[model samples]
Target chain A: MKAKVYVMLKEGVLDPQGAAVQHALGALGFDGVEGVRQGKVIELDLATGTTEATVREMCEKLLANTVIESYRIEM
Target chain B: MKAKVYVMLKEGVLDPQGAAVQHALGALGFDGVEGVRQGKVIELDLATGTTEATVREMCEKLLANTVIESYRIEM
Candidate 1:
């Protein structure tokens, strides 16, 4: 089985790295690029028959920094 | 316009960070968590009428480390 876990910063959190990317976009002459927020995705190849609940537990336990990020699991 | 860019390490690249996470997961008693590969997503809020081509340029120019990562855009 294959599972993909996407972890992203919660809205209202400051993303300095993302802000820098936004600034760079403007510098490169790309107009209307307002802001950027960055996050992570973790892809796993597991043995067959893994359940979605198990993947969610993985996200909660290790894949995401829940203090400032939210994660969604896709199989 | 809003663009979501997903950036990830190219396969065959060594991801020490991901390996560490996998190790930790096994340590925490999660079986079948075979491998972990990590990546990033950049979400942007732009003025209306931005083109996907323009966003790809943004990605090539600054948002991604193309030497080892690839990016896909979602509008």
Candidate 2:
């Protein structure tokens, strides 16, 4: 089975990288862009019967820093 | 308007970050994980009437490295 994890910074967290990208866009003449939030996706090809619980555990333990980031899992 | 850009390393491209993460998972005992690919998501809050063409241009120019990465846009 295939699974995907989307990890993003929590609302209100400062994202310097995103801000830098937004600034770069403005410099590049993409003035219509208002804001940008950057995140990551981790795609996994898993063995059969890998439970959602295990994936969630993976996110909690290693994939995401829950204090400042949140993650969603899809299979 | 809102737009999302997902940028991923093209198949056959080497991803050291993904490989490192996969190795870490194995070290932490996630034996069922077969493979992992890491990508990025850029969420954009755009001005009204921002065309998809402009967004694609942004991806082409700044968001993705078309030489080794491909991007998908969602609105």
Candidate 3:
């Protein structure tokens, strides 16, 4: 099975990396960009019969920092 | 309007970060994880009518390193 996890910063959390990218975009003349939020995608190639519950456990345990980030899983 | 860009390392590219995360998962007892690939997502809050072409230009110019990464845009 294949699973994908999308991890993103929580709302109201400061994202310095996203700010840096926003600044870079401005420098590169993409001023139309109002705001940018940067996150991550983790693609997992799993063994057959891997359960969604296990995948969710992976996110809660290691894939995401729940205090400052949120994660969504797709299988 | 909103746009999302998903940037990922091209196939055959070495991803040390992903490897490190994979190692960590094993340490944390997620042995079912066979392989992991990490990528980035950039979410853009744009002006009311930002063109897809412009967003693509942003990906080409700054959002992704085309030499090693490929990007998909959603609007």
Overall lDDT per candidate, in order of appearance: 0.87, 0.95, 0.93
Return model 3's CA RMSD, one decimal: 0.8
- TM values, all candidates: 0.93, 0.99, 0.97
Error of 3 at A19 (Å): 1.1
The list of candidate 2 runs beyond 4 A from truth reads none
Give the lDDT of residue B4 in candidate 1.
95
Q: Look at candidate 3 and tell me the lDDT of residue A41.
A: 98
Question: Looking at candidate 2, what is the lDDT of residue B40?
Answer: 99
lDDT (Cα, tens digit) per residue for candidate 3, span A1-75: 899999999999998988999899899888777889999999998989999999999999989999999999999
Q: Which ten residues in a row have the lowest lDDT in candidate 2 chain A?
A: A27-36
Cα lDDT of model 2 by residue, B1-75, tens digit? 999999999999999999988999999899999999999999999999999999999999999999999999998
Query: Candidate 3: which stretches are off by over 4 Å?
Result: none
DockQ, every prediction: 0.85, 0.92, 0.90
Q: Considering every candidate listed, which one attains the maximal TM-score?
A: 2
lDDT of 2 by residue, A1-75 (tens): 999999999999999989999999999999988899999999998999999999999899899999999999998
Candidate 2 CAPRI-style tier: high
What ranking emerges by TM-score with the best candidate at the front? 2, 3, 1
